[model samples]
Target: MKLFFILFFLLVLSVVPAYSYLDPGAGSMLAQLIMGGVAGLVVLFKLYWGKFKSLFVKTDSTTPEKDNSSQTE
Candidate 1:
């Protein structure tokens, strides 16, 4: 499974062209890097989102009862 994934990734990367003439200015490079980083982060978060949400989710059966008692006697 791991080998297959690596091979698939390498195949995809091979198809992508290296930095071309269009990315000439610093601004363009920065923009591309930012967009790429954001896209990668989204993919990463999506992959782990289920586990991340489950981290905060309650799974226990017992629910704490609400306290309605007033401080004033």
Candidate 2:
């Protein structure tokens, strides 16, 4: 992780400028990529975090829920 940060920082600090022209579509794509990755990680964290917490904490949700189980018209 430390090495990855160092490499990223070096790349960000490079004196050479990029000569390539990035169109708006490419910029939007990059934005979506970053946002999608972050969203995916958040979802994964929520899923695993729930399981992790369940290891030590007990919830009543494990029992059969009856909110919509009975319908009498």
Candidate 3:
């Protein structure tokens, strides 16, 4: 766990200069915008993935639940 944390921190730190020399021209700005949009989509998906998945899940409602199978003494 400690090693994982250290590696994660190092990976995060290593991305600091990824765009340090990128020019702020139109092309670069557009590229950054697209990257940011993709990142935003990824984060949004992570945030709502559970709800999204539940939307597609098939609930087994056809079979009535057995209420007296276990509760009866």
- Stretches of candidate 3 above 4 Å error? 16-73
Q: Largest lDDT belongs to which candidate?
A: 2
lDDT score at residue 2, model 3, on the 0-100 scale: 50
- Root-mean-square deviation (CA) per prediction: 18.8, 17.8, 20.3
lDDT of 2 at 37: 72
- Against the true structure, what is each candidate's TM-score? 0.22, 0.35, 0.21
Q: Taking the tens digit of each residue's C-alpha lDDT, what string does model 1 give over 5-56?
A: 6446645744644443232474465445435665644554453575568679
Give per-residue CA lDDT, model 3, range 1-73, as digits (tens). Answer: 6545634654574443332222337445544543566564455345357556756997663343345334432
lDDT of each: 0.47, 0.52, 0.48
Model 1's alpha-carbon lDDT is 0.47
Model 2 lDDT-worst window of ten? 64-73
Report backbone clashes per prediction: 0, 0, 0
